[model samples]
Structures are given as C-alpha cells and as structure tokens.
Target chain A: MASNTSDLRSPLARARGLGSAKDGTEHWWGQRLSAMALVPLTIWFVFGVIRHLGADYTAFHAWMKSPFSAVMMILTAVVTFHHAHAGLQVVIEDYVHVEWQKLALLIAVKFLSFALAAACVLAVAKIFIGA
Target chain B: MANGSGRPLSPHLQVYKLPLTAILSITHRITGVGLAVGTLLLTWWLVAAAVSPEAFARAQGFIGSGFGLLLMFGWSAALYYHLCNGIRHLVWDAGKSFELSDADRNNRIVLGAAAALTVLTWIVGLAVW
Candidate 1:
C-alpha cells in the first residue's frame, strides 16, 4: 500500500476512501449560521414584500431601488443560496443512490445556486444603481 | 458485502407510526426545499424590475393571476413553518429542549405559530392590497 506503483486504485477513488472528510462540521455550522442570519432577514423580507403587494411597477421598483431594500435583498439572496445549497446537498446525499448521478446533481445544485445568487445581486445592483 | 442485495432491510418509511417530532423534522426539510424553489420567483421579480417597467408589469400581472397567487400563498406558509421550526432547531442546538415532552410541545407550538403567522400575513396582505 505504501508504494504508489503497487496501488491500483484511481486517484479519485483513493481520495474518496470511506473516512471522515473532517469537514462535516463546516456544513452543520454553516447551516446553523445562515439560519440565524435568515431569521431576521426573512422576517424583514416577508413584511417588505407584503407591504409592496398590489403596488404599481414604479412603486415596487422604487422600493427595490431604496438603499435598505437593496442591501437586504442582496444579503438575503446570498445567504439564502448558501443555506439552500448546503441543505439540498444533504438531501441529495441521503436520497440519491447512484454515485455518478448524485455527483452530477450536487455539482448542478451548487452551480445553479451560485448563478441564481449572482443574478439576484446583479438585478438589485442594476436597479439601485439606476443604470 | 459491498452490495446490499438479498439482505433483510430495516423497516422503511411506512412501516411504523411517526411521532409529531419526527413528522416536523422531515417537514423542515420539505419546506427548506420549497423555499429554495420559491427563491426563483424572487429572482424573476427582481430581474424584471431591473429590466423595465413593462417587464415589471408583466411579472406583476402573472403574480396577480390565480395560479401565481396560489403559489405565493403556499410559499408564505412554507416560509413561516420553516422559520418557526428553524428557531426550534436553533434552541435544540444550544443544548436546550432535548426532553421528549419539550420537543413534543415545541412541535405543536411551532406548527400553531406558523399557521397563525401565515393567516395573519395573508389577511394583512389582502387588506392592504
């Protein structure tokens, strides 16, 4: 086992040996940390959206363009995607039995979350910047 | 040994009665996924706003439609449920409320609070709308 030439396992398989990744706590802690941040942020978001209910485009756009709303919107989007990805990763791991498919889905989730978060930030930034 | 084939498996989901705590535990995950899905609507709304008034109006029009309103209602309920249960989880993380009775009671409390909050939100939303 000590000699690389004697070992037949592929690098990926060797790296994926059945042992603790030693980073499990990162996922747990991140979920909790983001959940805490989201408590107040989600509350603020719910109330804000309700307040804007039935408002015209100009009115709604104005609210979205406001400084506080813009900042909170970006914060909410970023933290939310982070938290959501962490969560969906666990769900996928638990349920997806096929290894390759699970890996592909996990990668897709991460990429989709990042892309959506970026789109959200750009939208808010564009509106708030008025350009 | 690598393959799990021909082995007696443990009783699966429908094999036993689930307690309230267990149900809510799974519900937390369900709502978490639902909220993740709901985020797409949020993104669409924002992107539409950034695009133009016309785009925003179209977005608003769809959201005002019956199907869209139903989705919003479901999303809000899921949000409140997730929020309340999430706080309960945070408390558990702090090493409190591990008692079975406490967990059971908190499960009811979380469900009741989520329901009340959801109803109150829609009431207020419609009133102001």
Candidate 2:
C-alpha cells in the first residue's frame, strides 16, 4: 500500500476512527428508536398470542382479522425487522473481517430483512383487507 | 517505547477474567441475534395464515409439534432476555447505571427478571394449551 504522507491530515485525524459517513448516527438512532417502539409492541404481541394460545384456525384468523390486531401485527412486523436488521449489521461488522464476506452479509441482511418485512405486511394486509 | 523495560502490560480480554457484567453484555448481543433469526418463524406463521386453511394447519402442526414447541420455548426466552437487557441499555444510554456496583447489580436483576418472565409465560402458555 502506498502512504499518502503528502496530505495535510495529522496522525490524530487519521486515528480518530472511520470518521463520519455524512449520515452521522442515523443507524444508531434508528436502532434505538425502533427498540423503543418494540418494547410495547412486543409485549402486546406476546400477550395477544397467549390469549389466542391453541386457538383453532377460525379463532386465530378471526382475531387477526380484527382491525386493532391487524394494525398491531403490521406495525410489529415492520419495527421488529428494522431493529433486527440494524442489530445484525452491528454483529456482522464486529466479527466478519473479510471485506467481501462482510459486504455480502450486509447486503443479504438488508435484502432479507426488507423482503421478510414486506412479506409480513402483505400477509397481514391480505387478512385484513380480505384480499 | 515509553515502557521499553519489558514491564507487565495491561491485561487484555484473554488474560482478564470476565465479570458478570461482561457476560451479560455479550449475552445481550447473542439474544439479539437469536431474536433476529426467530423472525423467520414469525414470517412463516403470518404467511401461512394468509395462504389457506391447509397451509395454516401445517404451520400450526409444526408449531404444536415437540420440536416446534422447543423452538418456541427458546425463542420466548431469547425474546424476553433481549427485551429486559435492551431496557437496561436504553437506561445506560440516558447516562445512568455506569457505576461498577450498580451495573453489576442491574445485570443480576435483568437476568432474574428475564428468567422469571420466561417461566411465567410458559406456565400460562401450557395452561392455555
């Protein structure tokens, strides 16, 4: 590798880590914000599932078809996937050292998270809208 | 080097004993990863329901099976742990509980609460089942 000593940057400037991506802490803030939203969504989801525990197809379907239940399910799906995507990104970046592997995993994570999130919302919408 | 005398260096992670808080910190990340993986199950359930009664039946059969129940148990535990520890993290983000003793105490509290909640959930779940 060639050194760029011709630049006016100081050692401290280079050592200050990867610097900013101009986006700042958007990712960090998104994770926390999604997490906050999930705290209640998850609790509601768990209890709701429990209430319908062992419920037959008709019961479960009817419950899901309810307006409130459908809305909550969609919101939970979106927020949870968003939070999961951000969390997995941090985990991958921490442990995956190979450049190509890291890039591939990041892309896969992003794509899969969004795809699953969309699938979930679509599923709920089908149930809700009776489509 | 300033310490060219070959003196003992500060202990690195491998050389140092991990404290309770350190263990809990890593557990938090692990549970977060597990929950991420668990989302596939959620998607499967939702999609199955949206499909047809037959598809939903298959999904329900798997979930009600022994292996499926085992996976549910694990997912519930992971979810509860991640949720509890996540709240602790949010609190830390607010600049509290940085004290060594307080952090350690809070770790134990988080662990206990997660375990208790998981057991209680399962107990209620079984009753409903």
Candidate 3:
C-alpha cells in the first residue's frame, strides 16, 4: 500500500470514526420525531384492531372511511416507514463492509420502504375517497 | 480511552462474568431487523383490502391459517419486545437509567412486560376471532 507523507489527517480521526455528514443531526432528530409519533399512532392502531375484532370487509371498509382513521393511517404509514428506513440504514452502515454492496443495499432499502409506504397510504386513501 | 489504552472497554466485555445487559442490547437490534422484515405482511393486508373483496379474503385466509398464525406469534412477540426495549432506549437517550443495577432491573422488566403483553394480546385476539 502506498503511504502519503503529506497526508496530514490525524490518525485519531481515522481510528475514531468514519465520515461525518456535517449537516447536523438530521437523521437522529428525524428518528426521534417518528418514534414519538408512533407512540400514539401505534396505541391507536392496536386499540382499533381490538375494537374491530372479527370484523368483516364492510366493517373494515367503514372503519377506514372515517376521516380520523384515514388521516391517522396515512400519518402512521409515512412515519413508520421513515423511521424504519433511518434505523435500517444505520444497521446496514454499521455491519456491511463492502463499499459497493453497502451503497447498493442502502439505496435498495430506501426505495423499498418508500414504495411500500406509498402503496399502503394509497390503499388507505382509496377507502377514504370511496366513502 | 486514551488512544494508547488498547481500545475503550475491551477488557470489560471479556472481564464481565455475564453481560446480560449486553445480550439484551444486541437482541434489541435483531428484533428491530425482524420487525422491519415482518412488516411486509402489514403491507400485503392493506393492499389486499384496498384492491377487492376477493383479494382481501385471500389475505385473510392466509393470515388465519395455522402457518400464518405461527408467524404472527413470533412477529407479535418480537414487536412487543422491541417496543418495550425501544422505550427503554428513549429513556436512556434522555440521560437517565444509567445505574448498573437499575439498568439490569429495567432490562428484565422490559423482557417480562413484553412477554406478558404478547400473550395477552394474542389471547384476546384469538378469543375475539
């Protein structure tokens, strides 16, 4: 390996960490934001599930139509997927070593999570609009 | 440590008799990964419900089946545990819960509560269904 004598970058910097985004803690804040949102949204979802237990298609459709439920569902899907993407990106960065592979996987995770969330939101919106 | 101190906490991992807290920490990460993957079921069900009566029924049949129930049992347990531990993490993020004994106690509590919640949810779920 070729060494650069002119390379003034501190060894401490190399040993201690990887590249910093330098833009601030956007990722961390975004994650916490989503988490706080989920606390209430998740609770609502579970309770709603219990309430609608043994419900058939019409019941579910009706449940989905309520403006309160429809809006909450959209928020839940968007925030959950945003949160999941951020968390998974961190995990992949921490574990995956190969540079290209890591890049590929991160992009794929971003794409997949967003796509799925969009689909879910669209489904919820359809029910809302139909009613 | 210091740069020359042979890496911070290297001896601690080796020296600790049993790192129960450490184990729980890793399990938190694993369960997070599992839940992320398992969320495909949620997506499928929502899409099916939006698509048509037939599609929704097909989704229902799969989830209500024995194999699907088993998967749900595992995923639901993972969900509860992850949620419990995740709240613990958020607490720690607020600069609390640092005492070693308290940390251990809370870890146990998180695990216990998750198990109880999972069982209770399923019991009610099955009973209702």
Q: Best by DockQ, which number?
A: 2
Worst 10 residues of 1 chain A by lDDT: A16-25
Candidate 2: lDDT of A113?
A: 99
Chain A TM per candidate, in order of listing: 0.81, 0.83, 0.81
Candidates in order have lDDT scores of 0.90, 0.90, 0.84
lDDT of 3: 0.84
Return the DockQ of model 1.
0.66
Worst 10 residues of 1 chain B by lDDT: B1-10
Q: List the residue pairs that clash in candidate 1.
A: none
Residue range A1-131, candidate 3, lDDT tens digits = 12866755577655554446554567888988888788788778777767765466788899999999989888878888898898899999999999999999999999999999999999999988984
Prediction-by-prediction clash tally: 0, 0, 0
- Give per-residue CA lDDT, model 1, range A1-131, as digits (tens): 54689777667667766334745467788999999999999999888988987677779778977899999999999999999999999999999999999999999999999999999999999988889
DockQ of every candidate structure: 0.66, 0.68, 0.48
Tens-place lDDT per residue, model 3, B8-125, is 6654656667677888888888988887897688899888889888888888788788998888889888878878888898898899999998898998899899999998998888
For model 1, the superposed segments whose C-alpha errors exceed 4 Å read A1-20, B1-11
True contacts kept of each: 0.76, 0.75, 0.45
